[model samples]
Target: MPDNFGRYFVNAIVAGLVGRIIGVVKTEYERAKVETAAKLKGIGIGVGLLVAAAAIGFFLLGVLITAAILGLATVWPAWLAALTVGGAMLLIILILAGIGASMIKKNKDLTPQQSIDNIKAALPLVD
Candidate 1:
């Protein structure tokens, strides 16, 4: 009977240790998943912001073109010249925007995940 009791006690102890190990592994996996998700979200947000900026730049160019055309039709001769100049300025802006977009696209290292990781690493060190 004493031998049987000892065996049962050892089994219980092993079972408890296994359960704790499983619990710890599950917790670590969950933490890693959360961190990965946050990094992805940050990358998505950065891409979205850059795209939005490009979109706004394009929309402004369209508006400027429409105004330039309308002004050339309705305004006096002097104003028509000014409107043409404004159109030229709009063309320059569009060219600059294209260059800016190209630069942004070429920048491979500036990702949202990198930003998120930097912020996370910095925060722990700050306090």
Candidate 2:
């Protein structure tokens, strides 16, 4: 009976140790997941900004081309046509800025800290 009790106690201790190790592993995995998600979100934001800037640049370029064509067709001074195109470009920039601001305001919920906390809470460690 004494030997059996000792063996059972040893088994219980080993089981508890295994459970603790598993909990640590799960916590670490959750942390890694949160970090990766944050990094991906940042990358997505960078790509979006780059694309938006490129689109705006292309739009301005088109406006300039159109102005040049108009100046040649109507015999207007090239300098005045260029100035008008510049003003139009400025107006487009302001409109884009307003759109960007509104979009940022709407997407304010996915903050970095909140994302981390939400992931941590979702991944509860088992003992």
Candidate 3:
């Protein structure tokens, strides 16, 4: 009888531990899901900005081509206008790049430090 009782007690202890472990895992999963969504959104926005900058760069290429053709003409004013537009396009590209750089930089550190802390709090090391 005593042997049977001891086995049942151990089973009960194991069952409770498994339930707590499952709870902790579930909580961490949900937290990670939310965090990942936010991070991905930020990354998507940054990528979109970069893509727009590339498109504008291509457009600048066309403008440069036009400017080169214009330079072949006899007016200094046309060359001046081309340089002005080119300068403006370069500035725009720089601004977009800066914004995208900051965004990507912000998202680069994706370690779940908060999750780590929570797990540690939930299950402290025995040592």
Candidate 4:
């Protein structure tokens, strides 16, 4: 009778531990799902912005080219206006590119790295 009781006691303990583990895994899975969804949403927004920026950039290039041509025909010599406009546009593009690079650098981690590490740490115990 004591042997049977001991076996049952160990079985209960094992079952409880398994249940707790399953609960933790479920919670973590849900959290990871939510994080992945948010990351995808952010990526979509970033791509949309990039497309919009490219469209605006093309429009600006057209306007600037028109301005350069007008300036060359009316106000300044051809070479001088072309050089000035080209240099200014190049500098502005470089500045804007730098700003965009910095912004991307600051928030580049799209993965839930902290959660991943936490799960890795917990995995041994689960095993």
TM-score for each model: 0.45, 0.53, 0.75, 0.68
Across 1-127, the per-residue lDDT of candidate 3 in tens digits comes to: 9999999999999999889877886897778777777777787788888888888999898888878888888478887799689889978988997898788878766666566667678867511
lDDT of each: 0.61, 0.66, 0.81, 0.67
Query: Per-residue lDDT of 17-116 in model 2, one digit per residue for the tens?
Result: 7887667567766766676676666555655654675687777787777777777777767747675876777676666656655555545444455445
Sort order, lDDT high to low: 3, 4, 2, 1
Q: All predictions: root-mean-square deviation over Cα?
A: 9.1, 6.7, 3.0, 4.1
Q: Give the lDDT of residue 58 in candidate 4.
A: 74
The local distance difference test score of model 1 is 0.61
Worst 10 residues of 3 by lDDT: 118-127
Q: Of models 1 and 4, which has the larger TM-score?
A: 4
Candidate with top lDDT is 3
Write the residue-wise lDDT of candidate 1 on 1-127 in tens digits: 9999999999999998778656655665566667656655555655665566566657666666766777777867655665566566666656655655555454444344543454455445422
Clashing residue pairs found in predicted model 2: none
Clashes of each: 0, 0, 0, 0
| C-alpha lDDT of residue 11 in model 3 | 97
Regions more than 4 Å wrong, model 4 = 76-110, 120-127
Which digits, one per residue and each the tens of the lDDT, describe model 4 over residues 29-62? 8777788777666555555555555665676687
Give the Cα error of residue 52 in candidate 2, in Å: 0.3
